[model samples]
Target: MAATARSTTPEDITSPVRELVIPDPSSSVRWHEHDWPHPLARWHYHPEVEVHLIRESSGTVMAGDWAGPFGPGHLSLMGSFLPHNWISHRDDSAVVRNRDAVLQFDQERFFAAAGTLPELEALRPLLEAAARGIEFTGRTAVQGAAAMEAVNGTFGLRRLATVAELLAVLAESPESERRYLDSRGGTYRLDASEAEVFNRALGYITEHLEGRMLVPEVAEAVGLSRDAFSRLFAKATGVGFNRTVTRMRLTEACRLLRGTDLPVSDICYRVGFTNLSNFNRHFRATTGTTPSRYRRIDQL
Candidate 1:
């Protein structure tokens, strides 16, 4: 029998459809909250598996050949390489600053941890099921959100505990109404060479944040063309190629502004900006405040 078409509108996605991975620090698991109009707000994919919670708004999720409606407390777990996106119809598309709480982790590492600890051993089934993508509802949605929030406020070893606790809660719930989102079978994985090339490019970006940071230079270093590099970078980092460089520069500037006595103008050039006004404008757009105010606020 033919499958019924998924219900979705045209506004739910973007074109030239590229995939991406979430840029993560070298950690076992990571949690963060981002509202829409943010960098991760795009149609993309990453290697690490993801657990997503919709904290606000009503929307539709386009998950690889499937589309469905969602609202606050909507929860889902997607395996590696499964392309997905969420589009909201709230306020005629105004921005929501804290619309989602997300937890992402390396599947290999998480299962490795699960293998070592008997407590986590039970997660094997759920983890395997997640490879096809799982959506949680009913009681599981509430519990999962609570668990994600716990990790959000925590740091150090305790955060891992919260994540584990979350897994247990999710795994035990019979009424979670867990459903697979990917109508297609399992997803794809980056090959060894792709992983290496992606990592190398990431390293290059990190090390060369100061000056003359161009996408083509990094692409040439990684043996990819400009267009290929741009698409792959957007897929891996969920941002444009040039915007990634700008972000790296301004991030360094933000750190210097808060942690050091360096004058803002001097720090601008240090982080690759040629002019002060441009620096101020980018900083405000990224951090929601000017450099001078950020410095003073951090000092207080």
Candidate 2:
């Protein structure tokens, strides 16, 4: 595979907005079954809303500011331009064949349909909620998994029904788990100039994901003083600089536990944690499950 474009600078390289050209231009819907080492594996977003399911394996799911562990049966809806990615840690290759079942559709087309269909009127609230990114849970998630799978193999109107049913199931999600991922970032997109600074910072952080990262280092890399950069980044991304790095590292740690047979200690160090207890604590706080339990449950 070729690179993420060495022609661009680290800041330019880090812009997560993906310009998507759907496989079927005539159809509003597009389906993609990607293997890891997949060309689109990095953190990126598109204007089209995405319905995503992890068909096989387990890993970290990053949708906007929300970072969490996900296994098979994991289902999520991402609004237009919401930055997200899934990283699976299977081996040296970090490979998982047929890992995702994804369908992306135009938001404009969806609203156009909703305007004429009363049944789709309920879709308005659900679609609006998608702006901040949403995850389906409980019965909704189980049904969503089945619905997306049904969508994977069908065509014509049957395919349309599966997608509709999937959305309907998610629309009925229980209030507790059908919550938004975050309040900031989904609709409040940065302008081009502001994004350039952040894009560079993102590239710098991910490049050093396995090492101790300093705020000053990133500030210098992006050509700003520490204080100014700190304030700007917090304002721009709605999270502290250090927190972003930790989230990135821990997210990768979740992938390691689920996709590989590595021991907890080794996985901890590999993901930039020098201490086992700290890794365990952070894992529990972020994922609601220990590393061992996370791996075991996913396998079962």
Judged by TM-score, which candidate is best? 2
Model 1 worst lDDT window (10 residues): 1-10
Question: In angstroms, how far off is 280's CA in candidate 2?
Answer: 7.0
Tens-digit lDDT string for candidate 1 (1-300):
221112222232223233444554645787888887455654556777788888886545645544455667888887777766675544434777799888887777766775667666787777777766788988888888888888877766787678888888777867438877665545534454564566466546545656678878999988999999887766544445776567656756655665568888888988788899998998898778989998899789
- Please, what is the whole-model Cα lDDT of each candidate in the order they appear? 0.68, 0.73
lDDT by residue (1-300, candidate 2, tens digit) is: 111111112322344346464657645689878876565665567788888888776655666766666778888898888777775535443456888888888877778887777677777787777877887778888888888888877788887888888888888788876757756744435555555677677667655766778889889989999998898667555677877777877877766665567788987887788799998999898778998998899789
lDDT of 1: 0.68
- Model 2 poorest 10 in a row by lDDT: 1-10
RMSD of 1: 17.2
TM-score of each: 0.55, 0.74
Which residue pairs clash within candidate 1?
19-235, 20-45, 20-235, 21-46, 21-235
Off by over 4 Å in 1: 1-26, 188-300
